[model samples]
Target chain A: MPTNKPSLKGKLPTELKVMERLALVEQFLAKLKVDFEAAGFRRNRLVNDGIADGLNLVSNAVELLAEESYEDADRICRVAWIRAHFARAIFDAEMTEHFLGEGVFLELDDGGTTDWRTFASEELAELQEEIVNLRKQIKDRSAKRGKK
Target chain B: MIDDVAKLLSKWLSGQRSNKLMSTVVEAMTEARQKVRASDSPFKSLARKCIDRAEDAYQEAIYQLKDGEPKLCFQHCKQGLKYISMAMLHLSDLNGNATTFAIEQGGADESIIDLSKAIAAFKTSVEYTNCEVTVEMKERLKESVRLFFLAVSFVEREDDNEAKRCAHGGLLYVYLLSKESEEKLQSNAVDAEALERCHGSAISRIVSLIDELSDTNSTLQEASVESHGRIKLYLDAARRTVDRCISAYLDNESDALSQLAKAGMMELRMARRLIEYAKYPTSTAEPEEEPIEEVDQPTDNFRGRVARLQRLLRDEDEEVAVVRRLGVVNTYYSRARALFASGELSEAERYARSAHLDIDFARQLLLDKHATYSDLI
Candidate 1:
């Protein structure tokens, strides 16, 4: 049976907690990558194709976290999170086009086509809820650790 | 014998139209008076008696000029001018102006007080006298005196080029004055001859002084140029080394980063030395020895280089918080290095990432502003 515990010996509880938080960040990044790809966004062409608008901020955060500068890492993460929302909006627009057709979402607003806006709104709401929950979890964990 | 000597003195004073020859005779008479007193001669008072007769001749010349007797006035005025010139020559040794003149001859350090006094004497000689001196002559003498003082002041301030310029101006004014004096007294042969005899030697002395100052100015300018060239080379080398350091750091080449930082420090030191040399081109101070803290330790060397860069950046006047941003990068980089050295790989990686991000931001801002790294330095 696999365990959630780190394999490294003599790990402090705080270090283990930090490791857990980093794992969550990695999961979010991985999900973002997959979603970006599913939306026809190339990983290498994110900067050139203008798909992953917040990739630079994400990359900077990843580098800062690796360098053990938590403050700078946190700062870049906030910027990346905000940019990720913009990326999601772009993804949603692309998805609406791929699913229905170009201008179909606009037609839905004028009562001339399918109600895809409702679906997009619901999807965006779910994504926002997940991001808010994750951000709150990180903040709560940090506050608790600071108190200790 | 005393009466015979007095008669000859009067003849030299009245018959000779040349002030230079008259001055020479007066100087000889003065010297003979001193010699006679030293020899215990019973006729020691004879030389003193001759000077008194010369003074009496000057008084007679003034009276003749007032009486509208141009011929007698010319004779008396020539004698009068000769006496005044002799008096000034004797007083020049005691005055501060003499000290300034001595500076040109490499005799002593110049005193501004003495120089000003000398200039004042020249000015006063033209203005204070009741004698019928020409306005053009007085104006030229005043200008020459002013230029000479200006030149001396420039020399005191170590601006040799300006000193040379002022000296040249003084010489030119003296020449123009001489020409003007000659033109005014062209019809009067006696007066013209007397003016030339008195002022010609003075003009020649000024020319010689200016020539000497020009030589000194050229030597100083050469030294300044050489020092300035060295400063430029050092600054260029410093800039290149700093660029290499930044590249090495970005590439994660630790060894190259450390080595480049050391090289940058050396170039900065050279630049500082060259700047000082440019300021004091004649300074003979030895080059300072490098600190032992810089050598035999890569970390310390890197820190030293960073400190120097910080100092250089802080001294710059920037519209943005460039120094603060660079400081943040440096802080992160140092933390990363320390963590990495201690085997905390994950923690070190995070700090290094922050450093890189900050560096990128700084570089981007600099680029956006169309400024170079040297501008920060």
Candidate 2:
């Protein structure tokens, strides 16, 4: 029997949760390919043909994870996550004539994101300490800006 | 032929004659076009286009004069002179004959200095304008500077005709910009306030939405998480963009700051849309029911007050001593707010106290000496 894959749905977002979410997205993409093939879909003319372009990102993400490139993997996964969700949204709301592919990926490419709350417990404490130091910076800049 | 047009254009541009004489100015340009038509110069067609523009402006000046808008008439005359001079410059460039049109301003050295000061003032005035206006202003300033520098280089090479032409171009830019700056100064400062308010409002809206979504039920939690990620992502980018804007501000970069601010605002808008969608998937009806937070109102009021006070002071010939105190008040308030946001209450309170004192002093001075400006107080 296959074990249940870790997922981010219905849970708080954190570093660990993000990692698990990446795994979940990878698993979904795999399942989607299998299901698409089993449903006797053609090679190129599927109704959701646009999603096929996004499949390479998942494999690239898996490859990055295999190389222990956590940061790179996370970046790619975040982009994939943004694109997948965005495409899914458009597909749901859109007319049958509208197609998704490169445009969806292109728009999401510039979303270089930083999840502010994602951190381990120990790292959170360290981050708190750094926040204190960063507070000084905010004060300095604010004071400078405040000066006539 | 070009010399006669340049001389006539120069005299017409001096604003010394009755506006009715503008017809003669157009007649002269029409005569010049006939000369351009007769010339076998390789670039005669280009020269004709320039002279044609010159004639149109002179025609406009006549209408403006008839309308009793002398300032506008003067401006139209200057525009006419600019194109006419540009034609002379082109002709001089083509045929080795120097047909320089004298501009009604400082010499090359003085024009360069004045242009620099004018461009600087233009930048300050432009911040009160919309992003598109600010961008156009920047491009004009850049082109003006380029022309001035080329003029300087021509002066160095002893090419009097080219130097004069470039300096004339630069002077026209300075004149136009100064007029624009005056208009911007006269216009209400509310526009600048509205822009900053829009930005601050977008930020706080996203912040409050994130807070609410953090407490949402499990069924809604997944969608909230996705929205949360996007909001944080956008806010992070906006912060960095703001940092770039500040750097550009300090460095006085004409082009970068507006573009950066635009990009930052775009990011904020994206996050705001995401926050709405995440909070209510497929339900447009709910947002109308949700109360829009007016927390950004305070910041808007503060910044707007500062901007208005600055504009208000410009009209006052005498420097009001207490006016400087408002700057201190604004600074202290901004610092206090920043400190308060970062959880530094005691430090914030200290700044807040200073702000209160300054505000009280400025208000008292305004009430005592300038009763008409009580609203700003």
Candidate 3:
């Protein structure tokens, strides 16, 4: 037990372990090289063009997100999170009111053209009901059979 | 009274010889429920018991249908039909049970045929009944007959192309009609009864279609053809659904409803797997991973185009005309992208380059004209 050997108890099954590793690899490997190139262009624009032009650069960044390519979707998700964080720093209260009132939220939504919240919600509810029904059936059968 | 109930039951059952068992059973159950609730006699107990059994059987059948087990669903529906017929029997056996209304309604099961025959009969029926039939009744009968054929077809051999196509087309037509009805239901334009009839038919047809392909007995060739036909059908249904959702959302400026369109796309991708499998008959690997669900619904926003061009243009009046060129460019781009995605790379490149050329022309025009909003560009 004290030997420098692998223990099966704490480890994932070999198949599952391989699959988990593969999933991570897929995520990293599938990323587009175009995003990095686009980010570089955006950074250059911000430095050379001032805030208004910087805003335009950000708009371009958002456009890339709207492209709906898998890599672009991931990048957009990350950028949206980053922009929300950055909003507190650069946008003053009055500016924030104006920016968010009719601007940021709209742009944020515009970046992600597809909204799947409703169908997802409906499907999840149906699935949950089915699972609950199955659980009840199992419980009833177990009780009838005098099984723990 | 028993004689009267027997006469009514016989009449109703005979009437359903040309109509759907489900509709007949549902109607019978509703009337039985009301009669039991209204009556206080000891015979009411038997009526109540029969009604409850009928309901259970109907619900069980619907559940089986949703589970993608059409054979099981058919069994349940058969059971439901039996229970309903029996309920009518028991009600007839009662001392004073006679339906007040005339029972010879024409909505009986008039067309019963094998898959191919059912297809021709359905189209003919629709055409013939176009003048005499109410829109609601036409849709209801069409949906029910389609589902019934689909359920029966699933259990049959699929070696014949005619039978297969009949099943495929019938299911597709029903799905399209049901989806249209579902939209009306969502908009509060149709009642639950009509919606349920349409919805149930769609669900039943879809489940049967899936079950046929997934059956252990199905050959890969059988699955391939069926799945390919179904993909086209499903894509068309998805497009129509998305179009309705988009039109409603845009015209009303309501809350976002693009999610339905996205979900439809996801479903289309699921069907697309079979098409891909058909292309590579020898591959041992599973189908290619589906595209991420996205609301790729194309919107030709002429106004948005005008606004965008206005920002780029120096001439205000010329902005509208310039917008048309942008549409041409966008269409070429979209077609190219789609062709490329479908693995027709040469055609894709041609269309892509065509798009590039049109975009350049528009850009040059904007620059040359020095459009009013040229400063912004």
Per-residue error at B50 for model 1, in Å?
Answer: 99
- Candidate number with greatest TM-score: 2
Predicted candidate 3 versus true structure: per-residue lDDT over B84-156, tens digit per residue: 4434444443333221111111111111122123223333333332324345335333433333333323223
lDDT of 2 at B166: 48
Fnat of each prediction, in sequence: 0.00, 0.00, 0.00
Candidate 1 displacement at residue B233 in angstroms: 1.3
lDDT accuracy of residue B230 in candidate 3: 46
Q: Write the per-residue lDDT of candidate 2 for residues B39-135, one digit (tens) a residue.
A: 7754465457667767777778879777766666766665565455444434443233211111223233333333333433343334333213544
Question: B314, model 2: CA deviation in Å?
Answer: 8.2
Error of 3 at B54 (Å): 86
* Alpha-carbon deviation at B17 in model 1, angstroms: 99
Candidate 3 at residue B132, lDDT? 40
Q: Relative to the true structure, how large is the alpha-carbon lDDT of every model? A: 0.40, 0.45, 0.38
Q: Of 1 and 3, which scores higher on DockQ? A: 3
* Root mean square deviation (Cα) for candidate 2: 29.1
Candidate 1 chain B least-lDDT 10 residues: B99-108
Each model's DockQ? 0.00, 0.01, 0.01
